[model samples]
Target: AVANVCGFIASTLHRGIGLIHFPTTLLAQCDASISHKQAVNAPHGKNLVGSYYAPIRIIVDTDVLQTLEDWLLPDGMGEIVKHALCQDVDLLTYLEEYDGALNDPVFLDYIVRRTIELKCEVIDIDPKENKEAVVLIYGHTLGHPIESISHRMGTACCLSHGQAVAIGCVIAARVAFLMGLAEESIIERTEQICAKYDLPYLIPADQSVDRIMSKLPFNKTWTKEGTMMALIERPGKVFNFDGHFKCPVDDATIRRAVEQTMAPFGTIIKGSGSSGALRKNKLSNGDLASSTITTPIGSPMEKPGEGWAVSAGGSCPKGDC
Candidate 1:
């Protein structure tokens, strides 16, 4: 939090070079390096106080991802899948076809570049996240709360930010389907892609619906009127009823979506271990069995020994080390 404040201040004070080195695939695919956003957590919710300050340049070192455990790969895939679902249909197809190649450095680099490119296009159009860029928050409405609550509950490793967002995407897709905005097939496909990537397609039974619902009002997306959500109409399209990209979704509808998404996973949650069938399925596929450590969300810098460490040389002036 202190570093975020300092970075924001630095960006405001001078035009210094801001270089970001993303170690994990999650950081590369998600907001860690690509976005202009800087945020700090508030007492009420996450990222309640934030500003827009684009980095001078962002660097993603795919070579560092070789050390990333298998469970951690899905953290990055959540954002990759989110971007593909919101903008690139071909990216989605690529992910579906090559889900098993997540550990491949070449493939990982390609997907990371694609995800960054998609976000860059959105940021180029709407740097402030008011219009076109707002769609980038596709699954984040529910995803954020799940992430924060899970972290507070000491279950951050079990439900990483990416895992939560993947499930959140499924929930948002279901809501879109129920609202007649998206097709049933899209929801199924979303679930299948999440499953293929070893992501959770349903809400975990341990996550309290009431607790999740209580956090909705405190979301950073909330306005004076209500909470704004990025609902989808299709895989490569966002639902825009009015001129705005974000639509004001009522609490009741949100609750319904949460309930519906969680309904099917009850048996799996109860029958299998706390890790759920998803972990079992991933294990069956010969993926790594080790659990993952917690990572910072949307923050570029991490504690030493947590993520990839900087080289012995000084800071990277350009994106290249």
Candidate 2:
């Protein structure tokens, strides 16, 4: 937070002023530190008011991470996993086989450096997020809403940004397979990685389908006709074969993805219908026939879980409502 505040201030005060980033948190070190997006939250929403400013140089030390709380360490890994899923097959393998904490010098140094390289691989191509860079946003489509709703819903536990995005990645992979654009391995591998890290891949019963869907920031993802998403055909590659990074998808698919994600172990392969049989694989320890998620196209879905659903600080009260 200080880096963003100071970085943004310095950028606006004088263009010639330069800053070097010494990010302390795992999230900052892995993702936000390298990111040129510097922003401050408005009274209404986060990152709503700010500028994109790059640091002059970023210096990271695995030693700094020792002071961080255990819960916070996974925050950066959420993004690291996203990068691997989108760009690097080897990084994905590295995460799968390794078992270590942020204090493990070997894992810490390699991942912190690897994440930076993977991110730059894309951001360098489209620095301003005009295109391509959005691959980094793979899980955030639903993750942002999940993160916001977790805190606002008065749940006993709030999901960290990393945890929420980890769930979102699982849902995205499922979304691709549901749409018949990607193979089932995408979903399986993503879910496996999250489990390997002990990250929360299942939505808590408190986080309802309605609240999450309502809060999704689809201003960039939605089009006039329907919604679009940055889905991957497989690990280390995006499913944007149409020459556009933003792939078109039906509205029902996005909703179903949210619904399935909300339900515990909810991944039903192939709509049991007349079009054709899909390559189906039920999630481990998941019952294909029992989940309330069993619904046909356009049917009334699961209601929001019973709880107090507060608007996120009245973000949609008047102007944007």
Candidate 3:
């Protein structure tokens, strides 16, 4: 998000500043840099302080991606999968059928361009994200809170942005299926793609669902009526209410979906337990295979990373290198 901030700084200071972006990471190349929006995370919430300032130009350099840690390659694919869910099933099909190595630079460049094309299509319809573009945030409603709250907690390592969003996409799909907004196939396909990419499909044990609930109100999707969520009907189709892509959701309903998502795989959790504790933490494939690594990407904090080598999860890489 250093590039995101620089774009923001350029907007805040000058007449466009003729700012140009040379996005290096898969995350930026595929999703972050394509947007006309330039924002940074805040102590209060994600992307809370920012503006919509289009860059003069954005150049994707897949060659720069040669140095990205292998663990980081999948980081951008979360958004790509999300784009497929929002409006491109063929893209999803390609990813599902592909068996090649993800480390292939050729593959990386292809997917990056593909993701940018999808994002641009959405941006063309709603450049400001006030309408259709919000669909691009398919996983972020719950994902943001999960990532944000995880950062504040100390018991477990924080979930990377990709991991958090991957889980968030599953939750949104599952919630849609629960609400009858989507069919069971939607949920299954969502989970299947996430698992295929090796993205985390389960919430970490360290996170509190209630805490996640508390943070929902701060979401930008909120209106005086309540929060709205981005749910999909099928691959390439988002659930639309009236003329819009999101629908207003109540606390009781959203909480139910969140709890159900946190529940063990196929077991639908009833209400919270009688004694005020949650149901038995029945760990499944997700929990069983999960790895809680120290932040793989120490990026985009409200406070900029100081010179090189601040620390493991908080240090700036430029300083270390």
lDDT of 3 by residue, 1-321 (tens): 768899889888855676788888788888778888888888767888888888878888898888987667777777788888878888888889989998787888788888888889879888988788878888999989877765542323346677678879988887788788888888778888987887777665445567778778788897767678888888888888899888887777767767666633222212111111111232223332223212334333232211112334343333121
Tell me the whole-model lDDT of each prediction, alpha carbons only.
0.68, 0.68, 0.71
lDDT of candidate 1 over 111-147, digit per residue (tens) = 8778878988989989988899987899989988766
Q: On residues 75-102, what C-alpha lDDT tens digit does candidate 2 reach at each position?
A: 6788889988988889999899886664
Q: Stretches of candidate 2 above 4 Å error?
A: 14-17, 42-45, 263-321
Pairs of residues at least 3 apart in sequence or in different chains that clash in candidate 1: 26-76
Most TM-score-accurate candidate: 3
Q: Which residue runs of candidate 3 sit more than 4 Å off their true CA positions?
A: 263-321
Pairing residues by index, what is the TM-score of model 2? 0.78
Q: How many residue pairs collide in each prediction?
A: 1, 0, 1
lDDT of 2 at 31: 81
- Each model's TM-score, in the order given? 0.76, 0.78, 0.80
